[model samples]
Target: MIQKTLYLLLFFSSFSFSQFDDLDLTPADSLMQEGKIKDAIIEFETNYQKGNRDTNYLYNYACALAEDSQFDKSFAILRESLDLEIKLNPLFDPDFLNLRTDKRWNSFEDELISKIELEYKTIIVDKEYAKKLWKMRALDQAYYFQIHLAERKIGKNTTVVNTLWKVKNNINKENLEKLEKLIQQKGFPKKSLVGNNAVQAAFLIIQHADLQTQKKYVSTIEDLCKKKEADSQSFAYLYDRIEISEGRPQKYGTQVKYNKENQQYELYPLVDKEKVDFWRKEIGLSPINEYLSGYGIKI
Candidate 1:
């Protein structure tokens, strides 16, 4: 019974989508992004009343309320969120800065963290390993965004952008070394070992590694995906990467490249253009057109 309960918790916590992915929240999100906080709250409330009561919606609604200084309503919505998702670290969110001043904030934070700890302690076999992976994931992504920022603000070929790429490559190399050692010693941290996020983080490290490293782990990833131990989307990304590296048309169409001549992003060569959407759906990915749209590539 305990094993089943832990499995259930891991499944739900691992798969809860974010607000950005929830189409129903888009109107409120657009309003929030446009600095119309009160209007965003009203739109969010409208969605909630219409039965769009997912975890992401609730959390973002609470954030919108908190941003508008509606602390009591935000607190109530957040308390509702606790029952919907195993959200972590409510105490540190900038959106809840106003909530922090209220006397009830301390108890609310304690209750939130305590609930998460209770659930995580059951499923995460090695808390320290999970923490380490979280840090590694942060470092893995930190430089990429900075490199993009540098490319946009500074010239793409300028010293600042070049230096950022060099730094990022060095960090990737260091992260890969650590990840290889961890995989060697611990044998690919599965969901049960370090929790879902850590497992995904470890996979991201592998994804950033050289083609050979990605190839080395491809079969293992396939096995994990088959067993529901790892995310299928991660497997799709790695598979597409390997195919592109091997000079073959990708099967899932997850690989994209920037067209220097056209100033647009385009999908990589696919094994079968006509059936790419079918292949993507087989692996839990969206249609190729929809997926590439996120990269500014229209069908």
Candidate 2:
């Protein structure tokens, strides 16, 4: 009976470890949905420590940290998530769009972009291998390569732009022109699409056109942004324009904001009373309007 009980105990122990092996992101996700950010952070940290470092868990952890008003910690976690995603599957990683503007986020993105370019160059040079593997890997690589380029343009990462331009110079002029147009049409100047890199590529075809042409493309973007029709790129663009533009940028809290009184950017806490005191005491500025001086209200 003792031996049998020991065997059962060992089995259950192993089973429990296996169950938690991948850092089940569900609890953190649920807590986030319920606005239990501190609790979610604790759960996510537990999972992260268990080596379940998937992108979703990392993202959720970062989100939880942000919701708890820990901006620097959240950004750090986001950087980790971006790096892991790039390393695991550059072809399908959707974390890039989330971290474009973050200074720390850019370094990892640049590294991945560089690696993809190098890989692409090597593939192009190996004609014999390319011919053999073209059916299997060529389309996938091409698709990802195009996506990386599109992301660079949207993020206004000048190095990426120059690299993409060089790559474009090597491709057919018609294709390059198409890409340019798409960039203008999709407002690549404003945002990065996380998942649907292909749609961003399509948008690159007309991203920099005249006003009338841009207006024409807005409908196309609207179509892309529709829930039924939306992929990551479309949803990302829409999220930036609508949600992020409103206060979702602060959803994962940030310190930087334009101070209308001081006419300078200031880092203030999410807590209203502290933020009010920060403006008045730290900056020596009087509140012009009480209505505009709180959470979700950007100066």
Model number with the top TM-score: 1
**What count of clashes does model 1 give?**
0
Against the reference, the lDDT scores of all candidates come to 0.69, 0.41
lDDT of 2 by residue, 145-244 (tens): 3433355446536666567655544432344354445445543322123223334334333322233444555565655555333333333223223332
Task: Report the lDDT of model 2 for residue 212.
Answer: 47
lDDT agreement of model 1 with the native? 0.69
lDDT of 1 by residue, 69-152 (tens): 888999988778768777663443435656777898767755664677697665556766765676566555543433544565
- Deviation in Å, model 1, residue 261 alpha carbon: 1.0
Off by over 4 Å in 2: 1-25, 66-71, 87-108, 116-215, 218-299
For model 1, the superposed segments whose C-alpha errors exceed 4 Å read: 1-114, 117-122, 296-299
- The candidate that wins on lDDT is 1
